[model samples]
Target: MNQPRPIFGTTIFDGSQARKGYALNRMCFSFNDAANRAAFKADEEGYMRSYALNEQQSAAVRGRDVLGLLAAGGNVYYLAKFAGILGLDVQDLGAQQTGMSKEEFKARLVRQNDQPAATAG
Candidate 1:
């Protein structure tokens, strides 16, 4: 019998990368809100514009590519914020399997990584 390999599917970011994601999420959330949505609709580019972000930061948000954001400097906290803005409830998703909390899921990832790799015959 062979043991199954642990699977990881989520992207994780840290440091400045996380901060960028957080800031981007706040910006996106503001734009997506009903009241803001109306204003955004009136001036889409103006609303989408972010003053705090440099060219790379702006590019990261515009791309909407999480991995790209990380490559361009983003963190996990920011990623979580982005997920929230996108209406992706990480807590709910985490709880789906045995009611695990998001923190628990993150901890599990660490533990899983520490374990020896599984081999199949």
Candidate 2:
């Protein structure tokens, strides 16, 4: 038997997840069009309906919960479009995903970059 995957407080976007999130991701991809983005801004509910999102996906979108969205199988790249609609960027999503405040996440990134890589002896 295969071992269970560890929970790292983040969802892995696997094949199952991709299938589950197809509608949501496709809807997000539509946001690439200016008109579609404008339409979404004009009518959030109608826009969601157009995508035929399931209750869980719809709920996640309404709540603006990044973690919830991930749990609902939302792909990060596609969800970036959705987040952009709310004036949030990847850093903001990263903060939400990692359960850190934006400032804390930024600080962490800086610290990580400052660290020297291990040299192979």
Candidate 3:
């Protein structure tokens, strides 16, 4: 059987690295100041809204649904644009979740959390 196609958000790679995975034209944003990060974290939606994206674009941010955005004819470029507008440091986010990429880590975390804990013998 054919393997499922990977999406843009599925794997965390630097803008340059991501290009190797067919994620070209994606923009990367970086914030060095902790205060800026905190501010962005405080209200990501508000920060994204400040970008002045149209109704469809606004829905994409509000949903946090990458696939939805893609389904709506948006590509990695647009999604990365959204990330930039929201003040997200894509490179940092990708770097923070190292080893096996962010998507793999997220899946692992979900699987580990869902499994029942082993009892001591």
Candidate 4:
């Protein structure tokens, strides 16, 4: 069997991670509904418990630690629902992924955009 390759800074969401994150992803999926989102907002710990999230998953959620969530087997798509509840955007996630502040990430993006596109030889 082929082993999964390791990434330097983040976890790769694959079949194993999917199985590990099933409950967490399911709970995040529920956030698609306003009622469910409101319920989570009203009672964060209770909501997580109701979903049967593991300790690591619960801790990541509580810390708002995006990288930690990924390590805990979270899928970004499902996590996006949770992020929405926190009023975060993809840039915020990107910042976390790169270990930079949101403003730093945005500045990096701007700097990259200002670079001229490379041409094929």
Candidate 5:
């Protein structure tokens, strides 16, 4: 039998996660609007409060803790909006998720691409 690969550094975003993340996701979705994004930039705490984010979510937002946000049920797509406000990109998030510097993460990706694909059992 081909054993399943062990996933790391994140959780599955399921119904439970969706429920948990509702407020945070909604807040991020609001960022799609330039006015809303400006409002959030002007008053981050008030914006978070308006969305009713729980303590964990609020803390993750305050800390710019991507992994912590994921653990708090934040969706990456939504979080990407939030990240953009902070001048970060997906590669930045990937580095944070893997506990590596951005350069190291990019190099690792290149190394992986150079390797032959693994055969399925």
Candidate 6:
């Protein structure tokens, strides 16, 4: 019997999600090729059509919403390529997920790095 999975506010990119996002992931993977990225930049709608993305995926791509993409079955790793097209790195996406501005997120990271580890007496 298949058990219902707990999603704790995040989509799990398991086999079912993989199948659901195959076309979307494939399209993002194509971005690894410069020409394909150029083609997408030239005509976003046309590029999406070639990939046969469903409405949800299409909207997510158009909005560049990391959470939206994840809800639309996007695997974060693959979606990183899509994010790159918008000049956003993983840190930017992490900030978006955490509702922090880029500078705030960077500062938080710096703070964590500067914190001293607890020592046992």
TM-score of each: 0.39, 0.93, 0.33, 0.92, 0.89, 0.86
- How many backbone clashes are present in model 2? 0
Q: Give the number of the best model, judged by lDDT.
A: 4
Better of 2 and 3 by TM-score: 2
lDDT of 1 by residue, 3-120 (tens): 4454464344445545655555565546435776566447545654633555665675565555555555555354555555556565544543334666787788788899999899
Residues 18-113, candidate 4, lDDT per residue (tens digit)?
A: 999999999999999999999999999999999999999999999999888888889999999999999999999999899899999999999999
Scored against the true structure, residue 70 in model 4 reaches a CA lDDT of 85
Task: Please provide, for model 5 over 1-121, each residue's C-alpha lDDT reduced to its tens digit, 9 standing for 90 to 100.
Answer: 9745658765778789899999999999999999999999999999999999999999999999999898898999999999999999988999999999999999999999999999999
Candidate 4 C-alpha error for residue 42, in Å: 0.8
Model 2, 3-89: lDDT tens digits are 568788968888999999999999999999989999999999999999999999999999999999989989999999999999999
Clashing pairs in 5: none
Tens digit per residue, CA lDDT, model 3, 8-99: 45543354434342321121132244554465467766654554444554464576545444443444554565555565555434433243
Question: Candidate 3 local accuracy as lDDT?
Answer: 0.49
Give the clashing pairs for model 6: none
Location of the lowest summed lDDT over 10 successive residues in candidate 5:
2-11
- Clashing residue pairs in candidate 3 (N, C-alpha, C atoms within 3 angstroms): none
Question: Model 6 misses residue 41 by how many Å?
Answer: 0.5
Rank by TM-score (best first): 2, 4, 5, 6, 1, 3
Most accurate candidate by TM-score: 2
Residue 66 alpha-carbon offset, candidate 3, angstroms:
0.6
Between candidates 4 and 5, name the one with more favorable lDDT.
4
Query: Residue 21 in candidate 6 has what lDDT?
Result: 88
TM-score of 2: 0.93
| Residue-wise C-alpha lDDT for candidate 6, range 1-121, written one tens digit per residue | 9967886667777898888888899999999999999999999999999999999999989988888888888889889998898999978998988889999999999999999999999
